[model samples]
Target: MKPLLALALLAALAAPADAQERSGIYQQGEFIDVWNHRGGHVLQMVQTREQLAATGRVVRIRGYCRSACTILTTLPNACLAPKARIGFHAPRIQGTQIIAPYVDQIMGSFYRGGVRERWFGGWNRSREMQVISAREYTRLDPQARFCPSLS
Candidate 1:
């Protein structure tokens, strides 16, 4: 009986955490900050681009997502919540105000073609934060699943 109990404990320990509980707004630069502070283990997890790609779970953007958070747009299953808002701006080096073109390019590339054109097409010349309204977001990706609240 002790052996069986030990096996059960091991099984429970090995079980993956609930993905939904882990789901939340991945705010801008949060990933970068975690990576920098924790190196590889962002709380016992390796925060890698590949890891981000492998996340088949849905990402619900319910609030402002900026900078590094924009990368979440590329997740296999990404959705915008009813009141979700996204902020776009030129990338800046962590902890500094200097703009970084390479980073900006990477972020821009993650967006869908039409989204890129509409958001970056005009009126954002100064690299200031440009907000994309929930209405426009639904327009751009009509097929995208909306958060339950909106439905």
Candidate 2:
């Protein structure tokens, strides 16, 4: 019985970190409070990635940072805001397949940028690598005008 109980405990401990449902407004002193909320489903949000284009200069984003959101943040004009709480983990795809390239690029960029590992402590047991392997997207063209959001 003791061994059985130990196995159960290990299984529970080894379970994947479930995606959380969280929503809130993140405020940074550089500007007004940027609004944020959960969208689509858990572990996801509707970020105004298109809005970054309009800012022209570098724009920092603060939110419940994770895979999808991290990719969104990689857009040329995007930067991480001080208030951002990043969930440093591998990006999920469809439902199961983890996209390697995307994860490599995201994690590589973060590592190069000197992001702390403490930011990613929650991802220890995940089979997905913290790094993404993806092609680099084009940086925002200085001369290109940002189109407005229709939604």
Candidate 3:
């Protein structure tokens, strides 16, 4: 019985990371908060990609978005607050700091064509926290709409 339980545990561990539950609320074409997101597994980003694309929801980047959170920029209705900051870097395995080329390719494919070019041109993978200011981001992605302030 103990051996069977161990096998179950191992199987659970071996399951695809996307099968793991993530924390976020989905409300169709309403608001999405991709703010202050440091990012985790690439699979999580991929799993959410369809929802983001399908809903045409407004993704609000009101704070710092690092790593996979940058994927939000790919959404058709993504928007940034005036003070929002988006961070980018090569995809790396969590905890180990080991770079994953396949994950990086997945991330690279998410970026808009021009944004991809600009990002690749200026990116420094070694730095691991290159930030794009709201102003600069707007310059690079002219189609990225801005959210209106409630005040």
Candidate 1 Cα errors over 4 Å, as ranges: 1-49, 119-125
Error of 2 at 114 (Å): 1.5
> 26 in model 1: Cα distance from truth in Å?
8.5
Please estimate how well model 3 matches the true structure, expressed as its whole-model Cα lDDT.
0.64
Cα lDDT tens digits for candidate 1, 77-127 = 556666656666665555666765455455556566566675467422336
State residue 92's C-alpha deviation in candidate 2, in Å: 2.7
lDDT of each: 0.48, 0.37, 0.64
Q: Best candidate, lDDT-wise? A: 3
Clashes in each model (backbone N, CA, C under 3 Å)?
Answer: 0, 12, 0
RMSD of each: 10.2, 16.3, 9.9
Error of 2 at 143 (Å): 24
The positional error of residue 6 in candidate 3, measured at the CA in angstroms, is 32
Q: 96-137 in candidate 3: lDDT tens per residue? A: 767766776677777865668755675525445788887778
State the displacement of the C-alpha of residue 137, model 2, in Å, after optimal TM-score superposition. 22
Report the alpha-carbon TM-score of model 3 versus the true structure: 0.71
